[model samples]
Target: MDMSWPHQSQPLPRRRALAAATGLAAGILLPTRTSRAAASGPTQASALNAAASYANPVIWQDFADIDVIRVGTTYYASASTMHYSPGAPVLRSYDLVNWEIAGHSVPVLDFGAKYDLNGARGYVRGIWASSLAYRPSNRTFYWLGQIDFARTYVYTATAVEGPWNRLTTISTPYYDAGLLVDSDDTLYVAYGNTTISVAQLSPDGRSQVRTQQVFTAPPSVGTLEGSRFYKINGQYYIFLTRPANGQYILKSSGGPFGPYTMRQVLLDLRGPIPGGGVPHQGGLVQTPSGAWYYMAFVDAYPGGRMPVLAPVSWSPDGWPVVQLVNGTWGSSYPSPAVPVPPRPVTPMTGVDTFDGTTLKPRWEWNHNPDNTKWSVGNGLTLRTATVTNDLYWARDTLTHRVQGPTSTATVQLDHSAMRDGDRAGLALLRDSSAWIGLERDGGVTRVVMVDGLTMDGNWNTTGTGTEVASAPVSGGRVWLRATADIRPGAARPGTFSYSTDGTTFTRLGPVFSMGNDWRFFMGYRFALFNHATQALGGAVRITRFELSVP
Candidate 1:
């Protein structure tokens, strides 16, 4: 019962050790070499087109609190947002493996009403961990959300992608609420912490009909805020994460909300993971098949959280178990026979060199993007306007790299023709709280760290600044590398280095947090940006981009 415990440290990573265990029972870790296939000419375009063939988007960018629901053949996911856009990031996937940003739950929530006021303003008025619930009887969609941690409300939509009705405020102290519709067409809502509260929803799906009741887990188990409830084989399963003794599940045969018995932990902190345990956000469904699958995030510190998909198998006794043994979750499962074909085993993690005419879908901004700041041309050159400040750049920047417990990204840039306050570099940013970047100043490059946990201001210099190590920008190549060391419970380590040649690397600093801006649209992620006081007068040539989880 020690809730105030701290994170314990671990050893550093070795590439040879990882390669030796690639095909071991831990499931296949896609080889870092496969990344070459991603960068081949026109291959990115083909990949985007091929991604169109995928029906589910299991690997979405920055979509947190990942609650998924399936209707017919379509799967929908919703998450929290402080992004520039009006509402939280919502995506639609056909197969659960491929997803597209279909639209938002509230296309233009109250957050977008005042565009001029920025910097986590969208996060302040309320709205977090919004859940998507399907009303089968009416064939409509319902969205329930916690606003500003003080209010809860529900909105009805004809389609999951909607022109939603006005919000119907539901007074409740619960912060992250999960809504489920049962077999008899009964709608239920579950909410709250160490103990949970559940209540029945009115048939109309717009109101709460039953009184809220507090449910406690049997003393044998641990429980926390995120609770996902589902019914299978005539029994109700309440999936809760304690993060104390790893995450676990509780069960009962009662109604949607239950006097459930607590079950044992499904996945404990007993794997190859370097940091804390797998603290999941919400559960997901395997599309087209209606079979259940769990989509939870594993903390890859300093870099932020990475999504892990596992098959939830049922025991004869009706308890759910995660099949990921040791330290790996396979991309495919034999049981439950999902209908989709397996995607080629490719590196799910890597860096992107923007040479193509269009921006990759994987890139996202905090709020509405100022498209004028960026354009696809002789390499990706981002012009910094007067309105875009460091805080705004932190939010508006288009950044993404592969997400794994360990990986590295190196990008070459041309920043010699830059003006004052112009910064173009490699960044691993997650929230206003956790982020680190290598920025160029007056032709000099320095490593900067913004530790969100400390709520510190300005990107602290890690080491003395160094002059640009590469040749003067007349079409020369420069590289930045990010390396992550994940250990359970302790702060995840992220170290960045740079190179004139793409091969050799010099460490920038010690390993740091891989925090994603999702916690506030700034979850830990590897991204690229160019923000200048005037037009970035020089063409930035990124001749090569590479990422490997060695």
Candidate 2:
């Protein structure tokens, strides 16, 4: 595919005929009313309100490749964090419908200097398909992930919110592997892409003892990977994701290494919801009351693969049934049968004062950050680095997932420390991305907007961005904002705006198209980036960032 940003001959129509065709006016394409929710604090609602009932996308944000485990009444979830620092983000929940970030497995994925963004890059290739498990023997939690070009690593911690320790590295590939500790205290791993395999691990969980091919899917199955192993009521089960189909299960009455029978557990291909694609790849958990539920994800674009919760049960013949109402996935389901604690409603997006001693759990870096170049005190200070125009390769680009349906983010940037050839702004980042920011050239600074695409077929390399608009700025500080309207039936591209007084705002540039590239395997993220094109002393200080959603 052509990676360069496609140039448009004319600005986007102020009120496109397409909007009228869709029965939506151009004026309603973006948020017209200011959000009443507090911009500086978390939103408040009865915690039991959401817990009393919940939706399919239990977690509305991007928490993909999820593997969840239940210990007692508490549930813990782990997800893939490719190329993002603090890889293998762990989340905790009581009802499985609500979740909050607990901590991370690796503080930074520094397997090689490339992860640190020194010379090489790790885009689309850091940690993939991690398996999280709780070992009853030692009362320790384990996280395992496969790193491309590197081997698989096993991380261990006594608590889910952890000071995790890198226990060991296994030489075996184990692509999208899952771990299981049997009642006999023996450990086994299940993994494969086309042909599935099982292996016995040493008693200490450091090395493989033996291996064998257990099962293989037919060629008709498309894109089958991400195996999750489980042993329920004396039967061994393996759940594999077939994008062409839904989630399929392999069951064996005998043992881990099995003569297993294959059956489709979640084949409601009618789409994730009423008019969506099939939900794929996640783990299953049982509540304390012995109720089973499956947690999976749908390939939702511009917001990434979002998690969905579904009720489940076993058939008399020992097959797993992924429950669907009537003939489609329901938008809302009865909440999980767990204690619904009276806690503050967890906001998917929020404001960051940058006054805390540590970065918020919601914040993540594009790649492993260079700690020496950034600091957080009165605000976030990002010292510019000599990186190319490819924002994907730029260091210290702090980011969070863009909220779905509709959402808006605004940041106040102090560019007084910025030098010539420095660009500091807010961006919507994916394999394809666009930004609205301040660009300093020599002694003159300009408010600029640019958009670019990263060619996935060509090893995911980004081309120089195409400038859409620019205007000179006289001040050292400015506020930049982006409004994303990703609601179903709404336009895919979002609008960019700028403000000098922090109240009134003016729109800029054409509506930039949001990318749905599958290669990046993620949704667009709202990012804060500051990089230098010439020399390195440019710095940008962000005093405040506020995110609100409707």
Local distance difference test values of all predictions, in order? 0.52, 0.76
User: What shift in Å separates residue 325 of candidate 2 from its native position after superposition?
Assistant: 1.4
Q: Per-residue alpha-carbon lDDT of model 2 for 1-550, expressed as tens digits? A: 4434323211123112222122211221111111111122122232223223456667667788889988755789888888888888888876686677888887788788778787787777887887998887899998887788457788899987778999988898788988887777788889988799998889998988998999989877666689999887678999999863478899998899999988877664554443245788999877655567788887777677778887776666766676665555656555554544445224556788799777877788988887888999899999986556777678899998787656899999999999888888999887778899998887889998888746566445647688899877777789999987654333577789998889998899999878655677767788999998888988999999998875
Ten contiguous residues minimizing lDDT sum, candidate 1? 7-16
Q: What is candidate 1's lDDT per residue for 263-371, written digit by digit as tens?
A: 6645554332344335367674543322356776655444444445555554546555555544455433332222332232123345556667865444555445555
lDDT score for residue 302 of model 2: 65
RMSD of 1: 11.5
Highest-scoring model, TM-score: 2
The C-alpha local distance difference test score for the whole of candidate 2 amounts to: 0.76
Model 2 residue 100 lDDT score = 77
